[model samples]
Target chain A: MNATLTLTKLDVLRVRRNTRYLILAIAMPAVLYIAVGNSTKQTSGVEFKAYYMLAMATYGAFAGALMNNAARISTERKTGWTRQLQLTPLPGGGYVFSKIVASLVTTIPSVVVVFVLGGTVFHVHMDAWKWVVIALVLWLTSMVFVSLAVAIGYRFDPDATQPAVMLVFFPMAILGGLWFPLEGTLEKIGKWFPTYQAHKLGTDIISTGRISMESVGIIAGWAVVFAALAVVSYRSAQEQ
Target chain B: MSPDTRTPNGAVVEFENVSKTFASPKGPVHAVNGLSMSMQAGQTIAFLGPNGAGKSTSLNMLLGLSRPDSGRVALFGGSASDAIKRGMVGAMLQSGGLMSEVTVREQVQLWAKLHPRPIPVAEALKRANIADLADRRVDKLSGGQQQRVQFAMAIIGDSPLIVLDEPTTGMDVENRQAFWATMRERALEGKTVLFATHYLDEADQFAERVIVINKGRLLADGTAAQIKASAGAKRLSFRLPGVADADLYRLPNLVHVERQADVVRLQTSDSDATLYALLDAGYRPADIEIQALGLEQAFLAITAEDNNHGAGAGAGTGIGNLEAAR
Candidate 1:
């Protein structure tokens, strides 16, 4: 097998082995959608089920990607497996890119599981394009989480990875209004967050049926910033 | 084993006046300084050094993990990185390099994937004597078992050069013996092997050429017999009822003499001549035993001299003086 496929297989196996992480990533969003989102009838001229389905899917994507990728990197770093890989024929760029792809792939199940729960259990109605857009938006915006995970994996020690991830993921989810629609001070604060902008891109597709260029730009800007940080962190870690 | 005396024909690995220094809170630590050596293809060399002797640093430089502050290191007639990129060198570092989550089979397979041409995973596992444990999780394996898994990973690529830093650190007596048995087979297959080890016996028994380093300095580089010969003395211990230490020192070829209780010990360049002279002088010695010093004693003497010389010069002393001794 090729290096890319082989590495992806290894990572996918790891993801499959850690079923607890997958359950947590998938279940939290679904439970939040059912309990908090089930009672609501409508929001901003959109059905509550549809609006919050995007919210739950956004939360699941970000959580799943960061949880698995960042944790895996931290474990690899602690074990010095990354250093071992450096001595191999695999190029550094290929290792990083493979890891990114692997992490993205691992999180795909979370988006799918949550969306399926939304459509089947919550009985949300949407056009096929709407489903495609929400999935695409969730996947694309989750790149920010991938870069963030890479940075965290390099910067933090293994013992601190879980708490550090929790510290970042929970705050980002809450601030982005992924649990419910933001209003007043929460909305004002949430508007500045990259997650909020990303989540907004998904919800706007349903509420207005129109793409938001400003939100896309904001998400892209955040991704660029995090990607730069990831590079810097990875380099500095290698020096140690 | 006798020194092969066949110098490796092609230089597969070379270090040219390499120097590296690290900054610590106390001051700058010169880890390796102006070191030069080369390994010929098919040569199994043991790189021996005391703790903090810069063996790992030298190996790291040769492996391309760290760049030297000065000089150059080449593998397979090119840069170390290029050789590694070509999959010509396989290395097993001291520790912290194995992943704990995967099964032994998966770990080895993962490493195999990194190389352009890797040996069959089953072949590597069997060679390392871990075929039975291939399905076991790495975290569940013992330290020795994990080491074999690492060994499997290192040789999985069928690389021409294999470098191991203290490969037997955690292995038991039987395991270490088995490990060298595998290594000997590799050496017979014409693989150039370099390993750093604290076991002098391993160097004496396995390595055709031994390189000794102390405090970032190359102390000695030769076969084991040559190293022992360079110490230039044999120890002759005997019970001489009435012999004075002064009389023993006065004998020709005797370098030093000591008396403890009723026994006298002689350090001599020529044990035969010294014994003949002592017997001729009418010294009736009992329980006499002449011993040629081994590599361990030679290594201690060499490093001891370094310590004494380094003490007077303080911390800034480089490997300049030791090169003459080699």
Candidate 2:
């Protein structure tokens, strides 16, 4: 347990230093929110700033969570870091466990940066309890992408992981109304995506002060599927 | 433990009839073939082999990173992973990767924390001669410096069994000396050190025992001097300008003879007898030099002899000849 935690600590430290992750997960979202978050217009029965706050937070959280961990895992596997760790006293699952824990920790800054920007710069006001619940929900749902990242990372080599991540994630982001709220046929089709559902969970909380179980169910379903995929790929990769 | 460290020694490592095969485009490749060896506690053994000689495959199985198709690999009387978990084995692999962003101190410290009974991180750093580079990011360092960091990580645990695969691959001369000095200290402290190296001189100088493998089989196992002796160990060379090729060929104990211009070179099992035979012929060879052939020549001679004898049997693999890796 101590060894696992020590590895997790080092992993988290390295994640903090990763510039690309910071730019994708924290900087990009913060910039997007500042550019279009404030207006007299309302979105989903709330101020545009408040709605966009949740969108960017969700975007940042999942983006950082996926991009940071997936690339690192692929590169580490290619470089034999995973093989090196096998020689240590660390348990068989410790390396992946630490990576997951580090993702959970590092993705926080992405969510928090966008949240703080929304509150301070764009003046998105809400009850303290609402803020806490929304942040927690956004944080928890991002694990869906974290698991997807692991599955993709383990399935592909380092060279292929970059394009794989972009191809799968960019569409999910665009179709999910994360860049802007969706309506009509787009919104209806987008609702099936985990990213869309994750964003809806946040918006549902803000608009109605209560969350929909359907959105929760869709996100949770993807989480389970991806986590299973992660385990299978990780095991098969080790065999190679 | 200290008293029992010397021979009549307990076995620190045991590999009994192990074999592994990998399926390649060319069909099943025998990476290791019914190989067997054992190491006594407290021996500094060098594993010498030509490329594709199953050195890495054997090490991987011994460290429990991979499984063998048959037979067994044991460390400290148990499974390799158990021994490793008990803080009994420390290893540095040629293919192992270091964490990219961490400083040397943090990386070594993390290793220290991973082991159940690690030596102090500072002590490990000093022993590896990388204390000055402690603040530098590990990936930012040169290849040699990164190798030192790997060295520090390996020794931080202070395990009784130290396994290094090509440990000095990128090190410069000065650091290589320091690395060996530290390894010698560990050997003196009764640790079992098994290392694989491409540099035969390192095997010649540092290993008390050398095990040479070719085509996934043990070719020779002995002290460096003993192996050298078995390979017609010395080169007797001189500028005997007027000497005929026939006259040089008649030198007693000559295993091979070659000439460059007026200079003559002879590989001989007994340098003294060969020199006497030359002198008795009344040819005073000028600037005569009888240099003992180093492990490189000895290793080549051993492997080349094995490949020739087995050529008919092992040619189907398309990798019949040993690479004699430089």
Candidate 3:
């Protein structure tokens, strides 16, 4: 357990050392939310900032999980760092778990940035309990995407994994109602995608002031499935 | 334990009928062909082979990074995998498996945590002769410095067995000599050192026992002197201008002779006899030298003989030639 925590801390420190990336991670979603939130007019029965805040928060969490956790792991494997770890007493499970925890830790600042900017600039309103639920839902949703990223990254080589991750990342963000609001035919299609369900759950928790057990169950189910697949893919990759 | 401490004249690492095959586009490619050999504890053994000779594959199997298709690889009298868990083994493979983003200290610390009890960071740095560069990032170091860092990581745990594969790839003669000095010191401290290198001279100078593999088979296994004696050929050179071919060839036990403008070289099985024959033949040459066969010559002879014989009938594996060489 201590080894796992140490490894996770080291990974987080490595990410923090990248000044440009760190700044972008903290600022990008917040900037996008503010710029788009203020310019867009209010929607029927919902304020624009409130909608933008939730979507951008979801985007921030997903990006942090995918880019930080998966991309870094693929690069480590390419450089044979994973093989080095295998030779040590550090278990394979600890390595993967550390990556997940580090991704979650990095996603925190990004989520906070969106909330702070939205609350101050766009007048988004939420009680303490509702805010807590939104944060938990966003984190859980990020876990699912992080697992997916790990699976895809380990399945492909470093050279191919990047383009492959982007291929999945952009579609999920745009089509799954992360970049914009989904309604009518789009909403129906978005419901089929996991990211959309994640974003929907987050928005519902914050705006409706209630937790939907069904959406939470769906997101948790996807997380478990993706995490299992990631473990299998990573182990198979070691053999190859 | 002193690095040079021998393992009580017995096997510390053993491989029994080990064969590893990988699926290729054409068919199954045999990487390790039923290789069986054992290394005594505290003995510095050199595993010499050409490219694709399965040297890396053999080391990988011992490290538990790869498994043999059929056979047992045991380390420290236990399964290879279990040995790895016990932290009884250390390795420096061909590629330096390091994280570029971390500083040297951080990297070393990470590995240190894996061992139940590891040497202090300062002590490890001092031992590896890289104390001053502890805080520097790995990528910032020179090739030799990077190698030193890798070496530091290998010994920090103070494991009983240290396996180094091409550890001196990038070092110059000075650094190579320094590295060898450290290796000898480690061996003297009763640690078993198993290393693989292309430099025959390095192997001859350091390793007590040398194991040569070619085409996925062990070609030779013995002390450097034993290998040289078994091959039975010595190199004789002289700076003799205008020496007649007949006179040079007439030397006793001279299997072959070559003459350049001002130098003549002879391949002989008996250096003492050849020296006496050269003087008896009335040849007065400057800087006359008779050199004993080294590991390089012995290795060449063994591998060449294996190639000529092809795969032997035993188990349809190439390692039969290895046993013959031994």
Interface RMSD of each: 1.5, 0.8, 1.4
Model number with the top TM-score = 2
DockQ of each: 0.63, 0.75, 0.63
Rank candidates, TM-score, best first.
2, 1, 3
TM-score of each: 0.89, 0.92, 0.88
Q: Under CAPRI classification, how is model 3 graded? A: medium
Top candidate when judged by DockQ against the true structure? 2
* DockQ value for model 2: 0.75
What would you estimate as the lDDT of candidate 3?
Answer: 0.78
Which parts of model 1 are misplaced by more than 4 Å?
B1-9, B239-286, B312-326
Per-residue lDDT over A1-240 for candidate 3, one digit per residue giving the tens place of the 0 to 100 score:
777788888888887776655665667888888678885565423576777787888887888788766677787787777877777767668888888888888888888889888778777887877777787778767888878878987887778887887898888788788788777987777676777877677667665665667676766777788889898988788777
- The TM-score of candidate 1 is 0.89
The Cα local distance difference test for each model comes to: 0.81, 0.87, 0.78
A46-138: candidate 2 lDDT, tens digit per residue: 888887888899899988888878898999999988888888899888998898888889888888898999889987777889888988888
Q: Cα miss at B315, model 3 (Å)?
A: 21
TM-score of chain B of each: 0.84, 0.87, 0.80
Q: Return the lDDT, model 2, position B280.
A: 97
Could you give the candidate ranking by lDDT, starting with the highest?
2, 1, 3
In model 2, which runs have C-alpha deviations exceeding 4 angstroms?
B1-9, B238-257, B270-290, B312-324
